[model samples]
Target: MENVEQEFLSVIREYERVIYKVCYLYTTPNATLNDLYQEVVLNIWKAFPKFRRECKISTWIYRIALNTCISFIRKEKNIPEIVTLTQEADRSEEDDETQAMLQQLYRMINRLGQLEKSIILLYLEEKSYEDISEITGLTVTNVATKLNRIKDKLKKMNKED
Candidate 1:
């Protein structure tokens, strides 16, 4: 038990940022973000004992975090927008600008239907088509086609502004 606890702590220490980002991506408002973050951490702790290193630890962490976030988002009657970014190693002014764009993108994404929002979130994570397909249970071609359509939609929205 102690060993598992230690291992879990170590793994979390390495991946806490990913967990926090996913929660924030699934929630809006700081309070809801915090609540979801705690929930994700709790879920990870609960599921840690059963952890098997079948795939990359980060991938497993993402799967669990995304699923928990998705579930929480579904239960809410009025879901709020989520903003997320993959932290680049280089944190510069350009990165800051890109982050701002991501926030704006989230606002636009909020207007989309629930499934479209989910697909966009995964796409923004820069997941490969196969990864998105695997995570979303959608066919790779479907994921690609949907993403292409969503990009055009977003572009049209941007142009209208």
Candidate 2:
């Protein structure tokens, strides 16, 4: 394989979980997971050659993944308003109660708007506010404010559930 191809593959392998999680969270009934995943990889590959060492690779990849999914949804007129994420990534070994709780959480998350969902996902990934801001192109203060609002929204959702 060419050096660039090899490097791209390496980066994708290293960040596959991030890519998959983003795709998984954005999948809708019309936009299947595999379809979204393939489109994201394709986008990353197309832009790999032009990617300079300006920002963190993870941030770039996250941007591409999110943009790809969001654009695909927009093209398909799908905003991913449904929550059908499977127990395929992790926590498959959790007890039934834990799994149920997780499903409920996913359902609530799926109800959020695209930006809100993205912020919450990054927060759950343990990304710092700075990192989230970098990936999301939001100011640190905006990320913090939105995060607090998202948390309150989630809490309200849980209470109403």
Candidate 3:
């Protein structure tokens, strides 16, 4: 039991940032990001014993994190919608411009459906189509199709801006 606990801690330490990134992307301001992070951690620990070595640990982590975030979102549908970005008011002009662009990108991402959110997050992380398909349970062709569609959607969204 102690060994299992230590192993779980080690895995969490290694993958905590990835988990946080998923939570950050999925959560609205009304939903506490930390709550989602904690829920993912709990789910990971609960599911750790059943984790077969059939896939990379990171892939497993992504699957668990995305599933937890999706579940939390579904349960919290009544929460008021809000998007919060970091406010670094003291930054230089160039930094402010970059921050604005990032905020806009995040807004567009927030508009995506849950599965599209997971796909784009993995894509942004530079995962191969095979990896994305495995994590998302989409076929390789489906992953490619969805990614192309997502790109077109983003393009149209940008054009409308």
Candidate 4:
């Protein structure tokens, strides 16, 4: 039990940034990212004993974090007007152009329904189709199909912009 606690602590410390980033990406205006982060941490603590080290620590953490975030997003009933990143924080001249692109991309992602947004966020995080499948409990082919459709939709949105 002590070992598992230590392992979970180490894993959380190592992957805290990934967790925060995922929360920032998937949560909406009405969603409290901090609240979601706490939920994910509590979940990890609760599930830590079940950890068998069946995969890389990173992959395991990703699975837990993604599942927690997805489940929270799905259950939260009140959807608020989508908040743009610029509205959350001001851009600086020192900010990388890459960030600006991601801000625009997130705006489009916010337009997607809950499940699609989760899929797209995982895809953009450079998760493999197989990894996404495992985390999402969808087949690889389904992940691919959804990703292709999402790409098409984003492309169309870009064309309209």
Over 9-115, each residue of candidate 2 has an lDDT whose tens digit, in order, gives 99999999899999988888778888999999999999998999698899899889988988888887634457565866467578778888888888999888889
Give the TM-scores of the predictions, in the order they appear: 0.77, 0.93, 0.90, 0.83
Candidate 2 local distance difference test against the native: 0.88
lDDT of candidate 3 over 68-142, digit per residue (tens): 999998988876363555432223555767878777777788788899989999999899999999999999999
lDDT tens digits, residues 11-101, model 4?
8898887787667666765567887788888988888787787776666777777778778877775774464664433455436786778
Stretches of candidate 4 off by over 4 Å are: 86-97
Clashes of each: 0, 0, 0, 0
Error of 4 at 77 (Å): 2.0
In candidate 1 the C-alpha lDDT for residue 144 amounts to 89
Number of the top TM-score candidate? 2
Candidate 2 versus the native: TM-score? 0.93
lDDT of each prediction vs. the true structure? 0.73, 0.88, 0.87, 0.77
Off by over 4 Å in 3: 80-82, 87-94
TM-score for candidate 4: 0.83
Candidate 1 lDDT over residue span 32-144, tens digit each? 76788788888989988777777567767777787887788777747464444444323465667777776667667766665566677667777778777776678999998
